[model samples]
Target: MRITALAAALVLVVASAAPASAAAADGTYEYKLLAKAKPDECFNGIGVPYPAGPPCAEGQPKVNQAYVWGLTRVGTDIWFGTGTNNNCLTTGATLGATKPVLNADYVCEYAESQMVKNDPKIPPEIGDVRPPEVWVYDSRSQRNTDLSAQIDKRSTDDKYRRDHTIGLRAAGNFKDVVLLAGPTAEGYVNVFAFDARSHRYLGSTTYTGYGNVRTFLQYDNALYLGVGVGVNGGDGGAVLRWTGSLKSPFSFDVVASLPVQAADLSAYDGRIAATSWPAEGSVNAPEKMAGVWISPLLADGLPGLTTEDAAGWKQVWNARQYEPDKVTAATYGMGGVASYGGYLWWGSMHVPMKATKVHQKVYPQDTDEAKQAQVKGTQRATSIFRGKNLGTPDQKIELVYGAVALPVYDGVTKTWSNKTTNYTPLFGKSGFDNPYNNYTWRMVVTDGKLFVGTMDWSYVVQDIVSGGSQVAAPDPVGYGGDLWMFTDPEQKATAVNTTGMGNYLNYGIRNMIVDGTGGLYLGMANPMNLRTDLTDDVPEGGWELIHLTKSCK
Candidate 1:
């Protein structure tokens, strides 16, 4: 009887494992890892040994962790930009106040006191600076070319340096030119242009007015991008229309002005819509709250609108409309918006510990109750929201995955919010039943289905918050980011691949592009610099370009 029962358990185990590996074997989703960053690829010159001895400075062996920050496809060439050492950058920018000890494989260079002493003019909060690189891969010829040397050859005053242009975050094609943009350390935007046909670098430009940029959309014979206006991109936001000339690539006109930083932009129902980031400092009105906003009908079906068009824009929905507490509403920002299945679909984004840090600043965790309140205030995982006929009185919005009641900490009263969220989720709780899926990093529609990619924080759960206590790490059995597919709005999304394409170090799916055929190109976000042991079962972490090809059924 014991032997029979053991055989039955073995059969169950085989059945469970079959479906998990079926995607690769069944020819439905075959992933090919095309390119990856080398372990010792350094961006900046360092160390006193100069050219001969060591390539990098002491304690900075892992300073060049890069990611495919910007990706776009023109004709037969796929163009991508790499941003180096982002975790170190985030260490200074966000986590400097309460510097937490991350995993053993990662290091935060800017947090070191000696580094700050060397350059007292710059604070530790600004982070380490490293120049980004642009590359192109020809699908037809199967050749990859690094075009970063062109920018280096034309350097005049370090405008293209890491201090001026840190990383490329957005990429899109306008007319015959492919444009890539990134924010400077001083809070300004820099753009680089390339000739799409020749694959030649057409030089770069700096826009002093815009601080940060997110996504780009080409509609009605023109290209538009969402940008933030002031320091650290917190003051306000605007949507700028490209004038479509390589000679005047930097020239753009504001089509819509927003209350906060504009994030992802999408076109739906003959209009353009955008997600937003919460403004820095304080939130006051509904417009300032992070939410989805729609523009006026597209200037008579063309891109010739004036400032009058910007004025006609309206805030269709906001965080204030859903969250009962103002604090949670202000902290929540919308992420990854896309038009799918006759509706505008978007998800909420909560920067890990952003709310917790805010509450800590106000309440100081003086008592045990205040510390509990801080934990309660930490926002839940991302929730998907979709709306039809937005910006109209009769518009209907549905919650696809979210909590019925979102808890918030009121620092003023030093108590937790008793109110509940307005909408009940149709699918399930936020993050699709996994609380670690904090950011809806990328969303794309392909093959009559909607694909949603998430940033899973399970890998870093142990080091999320600072004060010496560690959160229990998630099980390593399922540690990678997630990709979900929705065939119908009424039905729950199916898991396409939950193991980050077989690399557990890949924490997020940063970018996705449809190949027009049955293939989809994915730009993976894996920034573990010190995990360079190639002999391991799963290879080292860095940026990787993966091609997912589906077999014709």
Candidate 2:
């Protein structure tokens, strides 16, 4: 009766007690696949493209995984930037190598046996290799154009040409100029601009102080960028603002320096609100959890608001302040934030790595250390919170989804106070309550409805253990990217579409944009070509763009 690794994985999926839908029906909406990336072309230091043949052939260039990380719309054209995976090109690496062997997940690993044929100096690390691609899709003519070559031409240096841009992380539109956040050769996040009117690459501004700019928001006529990685000499994330014109040589000024990584930014009630990843510290490090902070509304008019003006900001919510009593250590990070339905809504980031029985052998359930691990691993439910009237001290912060109640810190009592209430679950009631679906990756408010895109890792888990078999009884909760719409404030969120536009290979919808006609544009995130085993379903294991158009009901 001893179960194998593959069989154990299958049992976990079947035990979920949920049923999978075969296909989408006619009444709701329709999905159309727009574009997909070809196999990654090996290039030299001078931008010389090498064909995928003979010596350079590594089983059809295995790392064809791509994700649309940046999306923006200008006029009738939708622009997107993609990030490709090179983890599959490693020498002797296994997926989830850091985890225990029995409970190890190889969903993120690639089985390709491709060797680095051209470059010897390129390390096997993630960011050190692979270039990102940019594309433009015209809604009028329904044409998609690959603009990677034009973006490649912007850099003439051997370092940039060899390493390639690390992919466009975030995008924003200021007037008629489109700004994209990407990495330069010097290990800094640079802002590249394109004239939407003329359709030409304007120029790029190098932010040597920051490593990666991952999020952007335009408020009041200025552009605000979120820094994920810090400068070379210093550490910690920052929120920077570009107040200069849309021309070359942009001026960037640091507004605030955060203790952890800055994840997303949004404009709420004439103020800029930011969310951050948890800081690196001990398991019970109360100050190391993620939180939401907002700047003073009047600070926008300040001519020189720098890091010295940190006192002008206020912290409304911190994840550590809301931890349950049973959970010992939780990595509470915030992902996407939006101002919708008269409230500032934000989603939690709780990724469960090792909560299965195989991991419990390393740390037993009764000990303190085991309690901490279980809290961190098993408490993967992502909670949604909203604050009404953010600027006031007595602002009502309510938990809309996932948890029944959470503990909030009381300064007067100097201890955690339980804020118990009749909390509602958005997807849990519908049987889509897996921890993998907790990543509220992105959100957009369009057509009087709030659209949410989630990163579902159930497919990755199944692919890793089951070797990508559809015949196996599927995870009851299902897998792939999930799109939900909250049209009526009184009603629960409705599932608009799922399984990444019907392509189960697409595990997440990282980027989303709304066209001029209120139609939704979804960008798929399928990295490391995890769907290689399912070649019958997806011929190329790259990312795809899916357009979801609502019919007149």
Best by lDDT: 1
lDDT tens digits, residue span 1-553, model 2 = 1124334534454454333452242456677888776655432222224356422443323334477878888877888887765223221121233221111111222211122234443333332236666678887898988766765677664235324455677887776777777754345676667777766777665667776666877666677888855542125567877655556536667786666557788888878788877655623554445778887673555643455555566667777555553232335568878888888888876553432332343334444443433333343545667787876866877666665554433334434455643555544421245445757777778788887788776665564455444444344336667777778655667677666667666777887777656678888887644334434434345778888787766
Candidate 1 residue 449 C-alpha distance from true site, Å: 1.0
- Number of backbone-clashing residue pairs for each candidate, in the order shown: 0, 0
Error of 1 at 462 (Å): 3.0
Clashing pairs in 1: none
- Misplaced by over 4 Å in model 2 are 1-28, 41-58, 61-65, 86-123, 127-129, 158-164, 183-187, 229-234, 282-287, 298-311, 325-330, 352-379, 405-432, 467-477, 528-540
> lDDT tens string, model 1, 1-553?
1223323432332243221221212336667788787655432222222122124443333435367888888877899887766656665676444242345445444534333445454456544445777889888887778887877777764344534566888999977888889887777888888888887777787777788888888777778899998766867999988875766656678888887888998888888899998886535687888888888887564554455677667888888887776655677878888899899999988776666656566557665444544554554688899999897788999999888986666666766765778788998878877776778877888888888888776565433332213323334455567788888877998877777777877878888888888567888887776665545454576888888788555
For candidate 1, report its TM-score. Answer: 0.87
RMSD of each: 7.6, 6.6
Clashes of 2: 0
